[model samples]
Target: MITFNRVRSSILKAKDHRRQLLGIHETDVLRASIAEAPHFRALLSEIQAEAERARREPAPELSFTDFHLFAAQGTRIEYEKPYFERRGRLLALALEAWLHPEQKDLDALQNEIWMLCNEYSWALPAHLPYTLEGVASSRVTMPEVVDLFASETAHALAETLYLLEGRLNPWVVHRVREEIERRIFRPMFDTPNTFPWESSTNNWSAVCGGAVGMAALLLVDDRERLAGMTDRVIRAMGSFLEGYEDDGCCAEGVGYWNYGFGYYVYFAEMLYEFTNGKLNLLQGDKIRRIASFPAAVALTAPLYVNFSDCSETYVPNTGLVSRLHRRLGQPVPEMTAVPSLHADHCYRFPHTVRNLLWTDASLLHQPAAEGTFTFPDTAWIIDKHRLAGGLFAFAAKGGHNDEPHNHNDLGHFILHAAGETLLSDLGAGVYTRDYFREGRYTYLHNASEGHSVPLINGLPQAADREHEAAVLKQEVAPDSRLVYSLDLTGAYPKNSGLRSYIRTFEWSGQAEREEAHLRVNDSFTFAEAVNGVEEFFISLQRPILSPGSVTWRGQTGEVKLTYDADTFSAEAEVIESLDHGSHPLTVHRLRLRAGRVPGEASWSFLFTARAL
Candidate 1:
């Protein structure tokens, strides 16, 4: 059995010896390294630019109007925009102060840190327990709860104190430690389970546990207390790992794989350092497979298989990927672009710091991954073909509706050709109270209506754990074709009259001929004649409907979807919606309407993509 006994022993031995992890603790040496490294020049410029921006802007006040909006109304972005901006500013200003040691930067950093220290709760209102709204409304009195961001705030503050201790005013430094201890350490240690996330199997477990554990390592000096706390954290980390099956697929999709797994890696690095390399969490076959998920899911340089709540655009953290590559000898996708300073509005401290510490130039030069990757445990198949035309990638899923960040989209697929996603997954809807509550499926992105699947009796797929898709058959040819079939009958309710619904996808590609075709065949059986059936396919580009087919043209290529005109009629509808970023955009939904059909019927549509 794998255990952290060695970690506990190592921590017991290092009784007052505070260790620096992941980066140099001394400011002067760290600054010198940053100044001398050529690759770090761009990062330095970003920090400097953010410093200027921070200097120009006054910190936005976390006001009553904004803070109460989540409770008063169901909206979140009104408060979150300024809330994250404050954190981002603090991160940039602090890093700038540390690097340059300028008096002005230091002064601004002190003020930002002070402002953060004074906040009522480091946890966002959205993360608070629903019953605690009254306390949040007061904006002052509340029990300490270590949500994802609150724990992260504790780590950020503790690390700041660790790195810039002597430079900062004694009062500011003292207050920083006091706040973290009172807010994070005391609550977690005093009451073992301050939040239910300790046992959660999603990103919450990793983010909250990892952040608090890392903060404890950075702040707590008592050996016995640290060991007890660290043991609990290790258990939580284990729970996080249990969330993934043997195949190591993240059902929450790529964006979350970067997030939840990213934190696990960060905490692992710290633990490895704390134990003087005695406890290596990055070892083992399971972790190596988990580390390879991003490369396996990459459809293009900028896109990934965006199932569940993942964003269509996924930017791998270069530093984290490089660290994994160097540690485990795993392959990483070629990442040419660096994340901008504000790319992450939250300004995650560990991610930003590691982006400077762990990046390796050689790792960034690897070729993009190609060919088929399958995860039967999670029921995901991704195939990328490097054709003469460009690149043709097809991804599909057969998981249940009640996944983490669940969407009722079993048997949903994405088709990417050349540089465009002809048939797309809507990715994430804008996060709000209603978006996560009873009205969740009413949103376009969460409902099956927005996916490339068929509805039963004019009803969308249900959102229950039992509403799942079972893999009926799967095939991967050497280089020419891939086939996947799913039994989607359970995805709909009995009242919908659905007896059995089988979805099969045949993806065939010929690189030499620059042609790729995806055949989506759905066979349905009903106990009685259904009201009607509608097949919906989502795309970023508007579809042009012709006699018997619909064509979506992209800049470099186009996808022509041919269906039986005699059985179905096609039309295009535009939905004013939000992307993963919550940016307003128009989504083109192609609907194939079918009249009342017999108890047994089948629909097949062939999607052809070739060089334009």
Candidate 2:
């Protein structure tokens, strides 16, 4: 319902209003305050250190050889490493120059900006489309194929120009504006649907739309033209919100919630400021629910509900969280520490700058409420309690296999005790061309084999919306025990002869001891006698296996699982792989097998976690 006329009418008539959005004109005041701010000292020091390093080192060269590597070799690391490094350097240089504005820093920042403007395309090669002809043959031109980073690059340059207009050389400022108009604005306005992300219900839509809209808000002067562009971005942002149901459960997990929603908030704030708070995009009940998602999913301070393609832990953007808390009066998880400027390899400009502008130290003092929360719309349940020993938590998901950053995992659960996620969700896998293509499920993290779920007749769960788990029961007892059950038959292939598969979980705290216990009962009924059934439980800690019990020792605690030795054989396997960061990762898989089971079979497992 956001139209061009609505957008145009909302804009303030004051010429200098845009410049005052984030107090961009008050650089001297910011620099003075930032130098003295205790919380920002570490951030300022890191930025200064990185700026010094960048001044000495040559900017990472992005050559044709590196650009073509993704197309030819099907690997992303080779090109992306240096590509992101250059941007990281760019971000450092810009921030330092803005804060200090010394002749040396200004010179370095100007050179960095010019070099970025000269690049053929702002988008990464991996993000570019490979048509039927091939990547080499595809006409991936600038402005025509605007991706997330392309739009972000435009926003960065626009902000830089706005921040250092008088100081920067006239030529550099002119070139930056021209490139933004050519690369982002014209393509976005002229040829709609040139990029699929415009209508995508994921991070791409928010990041691309938000970044583009922010740049236009900063730079565009013509209100009518700006309104048209803003309308498109508003609609794209709507689609991104649509991806989440009313429950505000982010299907892609917390990492992407940080990414996609972060951008949405970035643009929303800018729009609100531009319109003098007349148009507030962050006003609705759904947005408040979405804003509270990170706190709801956190197992502890850092560990989160890493259900889909997400890392086990991530440093939240404190500025974004603080702003949300201030605006919506929603509870955000307390951030023990702020992320370093170099935390993001991509070196996003908005996140870095806003961290300086919006982060409130007082917000960290508000304590978050702890208890059980269930999202029936998404089939996600989470329970956490602070026992005498430590924090104990459990999270389970029963949504369809086809989700944002989809993993073929249903009826998967995670158990946390003390500070460790004993039974862990093997978060995200490495990214290669094939990692997203047909070979996606071959990666352990994306496959059901990597999750804590049962295999029916030696077959893993199928991938699609149709192949989904059905929640049969969810209830809480007066004694604070939680009981949840799911029908997981639809998760398997029809050929697997899975007539019915029920998984029920019962979690309760021990009355006499500072410990927690979880009992999982799995009942299976096949159309015929099944060949075998194997239950796979994944953990980061090495597991010790006995005849009937398996134990995983953590840094501060241990989780021991007990099953019937007569019915199931237990064994453990060490898996070596790469994590989402492409770092070497090791996981232990505890497999409990029931051989040659009858048409109907049932198994139970009791897991006990105690502080060491």
Candidate 3:
């Protein structure tokens, strides 16, 4: 479980060390920008309207409401915790207090706010507490509440606070600087782990912890500590980056990519801002390339197979795209709604329609696609469309188990055919409750059934020793053949005789025919205690259709497709039994496993044709 003391100590030390090394003071760049932005001006107007509504409306009668009871036993609250929900409501009231000082019930509002806070304090474990209210409230204060509430919450809250007030809050400035110093300078210093909440590669521990360290540097108050923390966070981020093959696929699925990749972008943005454009996170081009992740899902329409936990069928957050656009210094034409906690006000149809319109408009202007590029451990091939045609993209992973959101899927690729995605990678699932952490459905996040290579043993690559693994080498040949060499040979330490493993994806495409070729190769060293094995599997999915003949080539999985207009049907899958029953929705997953683990093995999938 994560501990507050560890987090507090690390943050404090980093802050102190930063002060000694940077010889600088807090600078309020983000705070001032937020105050002045046109977007913020619009947001303020919205807040004022809500405040007016709350005032004109009769105040609800107060009672000794059992906040915990509401969270635990209440049928409505049982589905979702009331702690964060009530906190959001309370923060809204507080904002009303801040905006309209003339309200005679200022004391009442403050009292109610404190009561809500106290309730959260009681609901959460001692280590975690409520920090900030929500968007309308102060971002800086939220981090404090997070830190005070729980270690994980604190880390997340700290990151947001660091972004909002590194220059404004003396406490934050000092704390960040101090923590950096302790973690960086102290030889034995280690970062805090998620307590109460188990530490996972996809959770608040790795992603949020890394963000906190990166944000510390922006305050300009703790140079020494910031340097140390920066070193650790960057290395961690680097390790995560190395895990992706060129295709920009994440094994934890789209949900995890959002969690892990979201923070990755957050930290990169902080670094870019703090360095005054000196250290560009986009310099490596790896993070920017991840843009394809959202693009992949977006391009695959109708089915919108975002299968996992309780995640929405369609993503509600477009703010991320907007943020990315800002980072890339380009306009994100199609953005509908930003993620929100409030269910009632969250989904905006206008924004959604606008995004769809923008997508259609952008597709009209085809830009010349570029060549394949290789990052530390990944390879990417972009099929840009200058006109209206298929845009095929591929990402091959060659990184280690230690990569952030790393999964066992090393050779996953997402395919965009015609104007739609024929083969795709499912994004993410829901985050509320323990859904994001535990649940056997967690296997949904493993590499086996994901859009990549699956090991027969059903063990995840980063299931153990998650932080230290790495991709020792990777190579992408001019012939479009991609090879990834990993050190996971030692992933199963109990079977130590395992030496090395290699996964290769060779891609060949005929631009004129819109057909592509995929060749997969796996090589592994045998361990005395364990038998070597190999498996070849591929998952092919198209939007829900009826009575369709899904044909494939016997040699290299070749496909010739034809759809009857009369047989077309649009249906969705309901999670009842294990298989789809006569429903219009159908998903076909084929697995070919070889019990023998050869020192070297190869398999291939060739796409020779396409049918709309």
Candidate 4:
């Protein structure tokens, strides 16, 4: 058992022997990587063209007032998000141009660099807490501080100074370092990060701590002081790790597991290399299991458990995934899609840079994994069947409602057949102030109603510590049927007149026949007769309805869901996906409503998700 505190004590001794081993120095990152790598020069060239195009357009007007405007508009993706992204990209271009000394317009980049260095605070107005908002007529009650993005913003400046040490004007580096100390270092490390990120169990701990830690390691001249600061960061990461169950489940969803954990690993790699492997940060069973999450949860190439605020269509860093696979001996997930190394999109920087630096092309050649994975830590069951003719899969979850990025979907499941999504989990919606404000579960995607679960007497599942699910049983028969049952009694309001909710899914696959199907049975006991129970299954494809069956036509093939017309009725509705998402998406909500029943009743349906 390696305690991070003990690691910190070792790191306190690290400064005495600190020497850079990051494969390339601040100066050679551009030159050496571009020379050795195939994709490196091309990405840099695209970035260069972007900077060239940007040279003609005046930078967008910046205002602290406009930054806070999105908070009132119920959107975080609109104005400020793009504006800061532009700023970060612009900074990267300047650094890139400096790295490419052959470029003719080096001074043009220097000008853009100066303009950015002059901005008030790199922190976005939208991320400001009421206390941190730089409002006039205010005696700031709290310390004038740095938020998560601001930490990265500061790192960008520090990283620029380090990378372009002699090439840039001396004044630019001095100004950047001064601001890093003023806005980031003094406020964050001088006092301490009592800000919730210090103890966060999610991405916050990694991005905030890792970004600032990289800055301290690169920019700070005080070796002993830097060691102490690095010591503190290791301790915060322990908090992130301590919250994980022994199963290495990232309850936040696969998207965030990639995002947050990516940063943690990024910092780990930097330290590991810097110490020449003396500090083995990648050690431990918890880490290996955490690294294996994507494979366990993935339903297909691009789909996985979108449990919390996680996304369904996401880009996993092939470099990071490959490294983890080599280390843990776990299967590398399929990631044929490429990723941008631009700073505008990264909550990950110095680490995301690894995507370009360490990506192994062989990762794409890894064999596909097909089998049953049971994560009892979070009560999630994933079964992938790779028949000779095609692929079919099913996934279901039964965790508490109070998970990180919590959603009120306890007994939700996803199904895929004929290589297309049939039943789906509409992952995260747009991020608005209200999304995180009061009444979050009211959002359909966050509520139980949006999931494939029954609403008891019109009351959706509750969202608190008390509302949770207990796994009753799980049977895995690989080549046959896989049945999983969970007790959902604790998921709803205690006084909702619902006595129990036992949701079960029996998935069967006939690999030899290229056929796959599922049976869902939900048995409930109520304190009294209820209004109605609606069972919903979300899908990417629209289903055509007949009397007793609904057939969903997708790219792969058609999936037919059959039920007794006399026992239930079905309907469908189309809803908008998240606005300004990475890709445009549309999905159908297929609802099956059963008439009111007595205190004790059961409802069941059958569907063929995959078949030849």
Q: Which candidate has the highest TM-score of all?
A: 2
**All candidates' TM-scores?**
0.95, 0.96, 0.49, 0.91
Better model by TM-score: candidate 3 vs candidate 4: 4
TM-score of 4: 0.91
- Stretches of candidate 2 off by over 4 Å are 12-15, 23-28, 102-105, 131-143, 192-194, 365-368
lDDT of 2 by residue, 1-612 (tens): 566666767873535558577644566886787788788888988998988988898889888888788888778877778878878888888877778766543777788889888887898888875443554564446334688888888888888887676888899989988888887887778764456887799999999999999998999888877877888889999999989999999999988998999999999999888887776889788999999998888766677879999988877888999999999998888576667898787889888899888888876544435789788899999988777666788889999989999999899999998767999998999888898889999999999999999788879998988999999999997887899999999999998888999999999866478899999999988888656899999999999888788999988888999999999888888999999878999989988888999998888999998889
lDDT per residue, candidate 1, 1-612, as tens digits?
345576568788763345567645675776687688776677789888887888887898989788778887878888888878888887888787767665543777788889988887788878775555555664334537678888888888877877666788889988888888888887778664446788889998899888898888887878888888888887888889999988989999888988888999998888778877766778788899999999998866677889998888877788899899988988897686556676687889888878877777666646568888999989999988878767788999988989999989999999999867789999899898988889989989999998988777878999989999999989876765698999999999878888889999999887767978999998988888655788999999999999899999998878999999999988899999987668897999999999988899988999998768
Q: Which candidate, 1 or 2, would have the higher lDDT against the true structure?
A: 2
Model 2 global lDDT (CA atoms, 0 to 1): 0.85
Give the least accurate 10-residue stretch of model 4, judged by summed lDDT: 136-145
- Per-model CA lDDT versus the true structure: 0.83, 0.85, 0.39, 0.71
Q: For each of the candidates, give the backbone clash count.
A: 0, 0, 58, 0
Pull out the clashing pairs in model 4.
Answer: none
Residue 119 miss distance in model 3 (angstroms): 1.7
Show model 3 residue runs off by greater than 4 Å: 1-80, 87-112, 120-373, 378-390, 401-406, 419-421, 426-442, 447-462, 465-503, 515-588, 592-603, 608-611
Misplaced by over 4 Å in model 4 are 1-21, 25-45, 91-95, 98-101, 131-144, 341-347, 529-531, 577-585
lDDT for position 379 in model 2: 95
TM-score of 1: 0.95
